[model samples]
Target: MALATCATVAGGMADFLVARAMGRMGGGARLPPRVRDMCARLGRPLRERTFSCVLVLRLLPVGSAMMLSIAAGLAGARAAGFIAATLLGSLPQTVVFVLVGGGTEVNHQWQVALAVVLFVISGLGGVWLLRASRIARADRTT
Candidate 1:
């Protein structure tokens, strides 16, 4: 249990930090003029949204964090927001994975349950976040 928890938290934090560094180092800030203008209007709130999206992407598959970090940078989110979002979004999955650590059975039903729960929550959350982002972008346009 402890091992799983540690792995999850460490993995999430690592993903966040790695993404932030890569984003900055890669000059991801060199976005198009339109995006730059949009970001100028976004002010600080953009940072929070970027963090949420990046963290969500990180919790998925391996190497996903790299791509998401780049996306966040290009999208204009700050490092602190990225890290916070990664940690906040990853907490639930980390807990679930840790809870499932005790199962030893190959045919364990609990494992399936855990996977399903994770999938549902992740999918729902992703949709909600995306919608919110779209709304935010639209608001900035007007």
Candidate 2:
């Protein structure tokens, strides 16, 4: 179990790093034209509140850091800025997951509670990001 936990955590970190790097490289440019067009249409709103929304989303585990990085990059934020913000915002929650996984289970309730909290937080962050993405796409159009 411990080994699995460690591997999972390490894999998560690696995936996040890979995503961030790819995002910085402009992953969005490779998107289908239709998707790009949609994003472009709603780019304006995202531009208006990109920083706050991105920061919050990055802090939540609902979205992966790499995915977030791609989003921020596609939204017109600087790659370095987005990467830095994502790292900072995600550190706490990522630590929580890693720490939790390091130990064995005593009671299932605690695990359930943690899962619930993470789910709630991630859900809220997702809504915020969705709104922000729409805004960002709109901004690009104008």
Candidate 3:
């Protein structure tokens, strides 16, 4: 659990920092000027609420980890916020993995059941967050 949570957090932070530096150097070089401008405008709120945004995204488990890390960095998320969110958000998933990996045959059923419950909850919450984010984005655009 410690390895999964802490080590992975370190990896994510590294990815984030590297991506951020890359973003600073020339992240939008290939994008058309119009698209770059639009991305900058849309990234405002994410930059403002970096912790909450990153935390929710880390918890969701829907996208590529590399992409999320890159996006967070490119959007100029705070270092502390990104680290804290990644650490906290990885806990539940680490719990499920630890339980499954260590449990005995007799103990495994309940652990598996708990894992399923957690997964279902995560899925539903991801859907809710996605809808809310879309609505918020729409409202902002309008």
Q: What TM-score does each of the candidates earn?
A: 0.51, 0.47, 0.76
> Residue by residue across 37-111, what tens digits does model 1's lDDT show?
543444344455566555545454334443444445545576676667666666666656554664446877787
Query: For model 3, where is the 10-residue window of minimal lDDT?
Result: 133-142
Candidate 2 has an lDDT of 0.54
lDDT of 2 by residue, 21-74 (tens): 654687767776865664465354334665555566565565344544434445
Model 2, which residues run further than 4 Å from truth? 1-29, 33-50, 60-64, 105-142
Evaluate all candidate structures by whole-model CA lDDT and list the values in order.
0.56, 0.54, 0.70
Candidate 3 segments whose C-alpha is farther than 4 A from its true place:
27-42, 103-107, 129-142
Clashing pairs in 3: none
User: Mind giving the per-residue lDDT tens digits that candidate 3 earns over 1-142?
Assistant: 7888888798888988887887899965665575455446536655776676666666776666656666677778788988887887767767777777766577468888887687667667766765666524632763
Best by lDDT: 3
Model 1 shows how many backbone clashes? 0
lDDT (C-alpha) at residue 120 in model 1: 71
Clashing pairs in model 1? none
Where is model 1 more than 4 Å wrong at Cα?
Answer: 1-48, 55-63, 73-76, 99-101, 104-107, 135-142
Query: Which structure among the candidates has the greatest TM-score?
Result: 3
| lDDT minimum window of 10 residues, candidate 1 | 61-70
